[model samples]
Target: MQPVVHIGAGAPGARIRWGPSPRAFGSGLALFALLAVGCSEPVPPTVTEPKPPGLESEPRWLTFKCVKPGCDETLDVTIRQVGARKLAIKRVVLSEPDRTEYSIESELSAPAIVNEQFKVSVRYRPIGGPVKGDVKLLVTYTDASPEEGEGRIPPGEVSVPLLRRLVGEPVLVASPARLVFGAVSPGESRSLPLTVSNAGSGNSSLVISAVDSDEPTIGAQALPALGLAPGSSTEVQMGYAPQAAAYSEARLLVRSAGDMVAPVEVLAVGTSLPDPTVAALPAEGLDFGRVEKGTQKRASIEVVNRGGAPLELESVRVVGNANLAATLPNEATSLTLAPLESVEVMVWLSSETSGDIDAYVELTTNDPSARLFSVPVVGMVTAPHAVAPGSIDFGKVPKGWVLTRPITVQNEGWGELEVKGLTLVLGSSDLFTLRSLPSLPLSLERHQKLGLEVEFRAEAMGPFQATLSVETNDPGGRFLEVPIRATGSTCAEGCPLENAVPSCVGNECSIASCESGWFDTDGEPENGCECSEIGNDPGSSCQEAHYLGEFPDDGTSQTFRGILPWKNDVDTVTFFAKDAFNWGADRYDVRISLASADPSIRLCVYWHETGNHLSECYLENENCPESRSFQRTGTGGGDDADYVVKIYREPGAAPTCKPYTLSVSNG
Candidate 1:
């Protein structure tokens, strides 16, 4: 057996000695040796130092390529545990002195072993211009001890700072950001230049995929895939072609390849020319109708510009008739009308000859289609002819009774008739006298008639005859002679009633007829039909109104005669409405005029159904008559509407028996 040598624990250079044989020492020696080794100051353990925790990132600096403002770019930073110990990441932080443009998206959660890799995602969004920031990783070494259960022991964390710079910027810019093409006519095309450039701070080139327009009418010139170096620009044409006149706009979008930068927007604007047109009001033409000869009639012709552009009127003239003339409203020969504007041309027709007139007002304007437009001027002039009955007979009039007969002379021709003279023929009966003769040299228009009344008084029973002469300016009938005749009869009793004619019935005097505005109210013959219109006033209220019968809707004026005996007397008269064929009883206008020789008569009108006063009391005078007019619409059904007119004397006026005439007409 080989003997074993044991070295005793010593400070330095300890001696080695041979121990007894294994047979002789046995287990005791072995135990002693083990105790010797255990009892001696335990050799200081050969301690092995643990490797320090270390982190190494792939990219030391982060660089982000942002296309434009408010654009984000992400970059992944791979962190690896290079040391022998495990490492834990406590936190990740993004820091910047100015604006915060960087953020950590994802980070490692568990502790990393040796050679283990983890990633921290960082996102960068540039506000504007050049921007930079830092990313810090807080990490510490993890403990090597085992955990109580299946989990690892919580490591005492000590954060280690890691920083990286982030840079983000824009690369493309547009020059002359807006393009305007002004006043492009319809079916016309116009274009303006737009510039696109690369504005990157670095040496990178900018690639534009396309330049497009949003509007169909507005477009940009086609460009191949273009690449612009930094600080270099390229020009493209922005075009506008309008099919019709209108305002249009569009955006010229410049898109970069790969969306490295935001799409550059260039606003484009344009306008199209407007068209001008001329039109005439009353497109048919003007007609003077039947105008009186030797007189002038005036009318108007309106020239309008119906389009969106200004219209130029060259000249307005009248032709085809020497007497027809046309003048602009301002007497100017030429004028300009704005869009949707109009100008009136005054036209006058005068002639001494009597005939149908055919003329035209010619208008010259800048309207391409209607350069020469004509408005017809048509009218007729005629001479007046006197028309009268050859003779008028009064039949038989009672003795001591007076009566008047009408001698009507009308102008049946189409011109003014001047009555030069009206006289009784020489050597005519003295019993016949002309009464209510229209003043000499009276004028009458076409279809107008004048009444020359001949009054006959029966002083004694006889036959009266006279010849009335009427001279006028009628070319055919210059002078007209109308015979007036009346027979007077003897009555047993003379008619003594004022304003009453006597009728002898079996040798008794009775009332035959009373004068206008007078009535025979009392039956007694002694009074002799003595009741004037004032004696039986119509009424003072609508309920007691006296119906004056329905008036026609032909616009013919009718006169009603009445006498006011005293002051404070009111006469209410009602008339049923006639259908004007305008929505039932809706009358266009109802006019009532009051006139009297005494100038003290006043008039008032009211709508009877509603009892609403239409007109306050108005006093009449020689120059200006009192009148009231109203339009009754939606009032009644057809002829069922009734209107009341009240007549009275002016306040504080003296009582008199003067008669008044109320003229009423509706259209």
Candidate 2:
């Protein structure tokens, strides 16, 4: 017999029954008899389903739009758990070739439990040009709970790779970014050719919406509108037309549609022309009012074209009086004037007999209103004349000193001379005075004379000049001028310092500055600059280097000291190496050392005649010693070849007062 087990639905219990079977009837009947007699029914085994933890991302991929270079764009991504169990986010990072341009702005705590949803912000910033390729976002996480459902999910960390795509937009570029219309007339215009091209990466075409200008005088025009494919170009004309005489500037803005690049600005500049006009100095008229008989009086008129156009002078002449004469510039009969050009016309009057004269100067020009211009000239010839000393000089006088001189006024012509007044004119008039002048309107016959005195007082140091005017009735000598000059000095004996500039301080003579290559070492104004730095002389050169005595054969060092008197000043000295006592040794080592309190001082060694560089040394700190060693072939009894040593301040270093010492010895 065979036994079978059955589970009841109503209660948690199981029942067993036996079936007829030849193979297992013996054992089955024995097991059934024992279960039925010794044990109760076996309870049914309990069972339950397992739930695993999982993570779900809001965005599977990231996309960024870069409007222009150096523009930043930002986006956010959400992460949450979809399964029943929670997950911990370990870390988030960006990985790519151009990963530097992308950044993760959101801060995430390591091993954080994600029960709800969390957001991660990402930003993209392009530096220059077009950005290419994509970046990957790597999110690393691990299971926060233990294994479930008989180890369905392994206990370890996991990483999810997310992709980001970068798209480049269209950019506009212009050749010859600036336009210059040098000079344009008021009614004319100038244009410069410009080529516009698309410099972006992608299949998008650059479409220009409008071209605008900031100034009315400047404009831009494109041929057949503006639409260029990638790596394609179009021609444009930049124009400038000014309405007046002035400098103008404008910015031409090239606007595009849906372009990542900003509007391109092309600067346009130009200048306009000015109108043509004529002008003249002494515009009223020419007046040779009065003059002495047998004397000639001259006058001049300046004509100028003060505009942008040319001016034509058909003729310039004197037409009225027989005594009047006219002379043109360069003795030309006709003249042409360029813009802002000028010329002078000379006119004179001469007559043997005494009488009144009247004349007019005729100027024929291309001026619309004034076709023929006339300038009136009037004068009278007289017989009386006056003469006096032309000038008086007081020479150099000490300050606070006074000096006086005599002036004589005489009548030399045929008629009687009438004296009106005497006056001092122009520069430093307060320093000069007229003394013992005769009464007004005094009369004197021909060959008669009048005596007068002029005094000058020196108040300050410098040159002083003035004019003495003697008024009279003479035709040519109505106002006779005599120039007077004097110079005032601080000291009566003047400055006597050698190689020094003189100055006055507290009413005492002093030294202001010393001549080149000279210094005031003693601080004494009496002796001037007594110390002369011969090493800094302009005539000193490498050929004239100073000679330093040969090194001692007893192996003792020889020391020499000097100061760099000026910046970039080089002091060269040469010395001979003494022969060594060793009979077979033909060469010996010589050590050159330098010490200075200034770090800018440097020393160099060279062959005297050949100028070949041997060695050089520079100090890193003050008072620190630097040295160089070089081999020199020695003779038995005589000195070896001379080696040149140069001590100078390093280039681009400020001049210092510190001194340096150079020592040479045999090693």
lDDT of each: 0.67, 0.67
lDDT of 1 by residue, 411-485 (tens): 887667899988888977888888887777889987789987887777777777889999999977777998888
Off by over 4 Å in 2: 1-276, 287-290, 351-358, 376-380, 384-416, 419-667
Best by TM-score: 1
Error of 2 at 255 (Å): 44
Model 2's TM-score against the true structure: 0.21
TM-score of decoy 1: 0.29
Positional deviation of 17 in candidate 1, in angstroms?
99
Candidate 1 lDDT score relative to the true structure:
0.67
* Error at 248, model 2, angstroms: 18
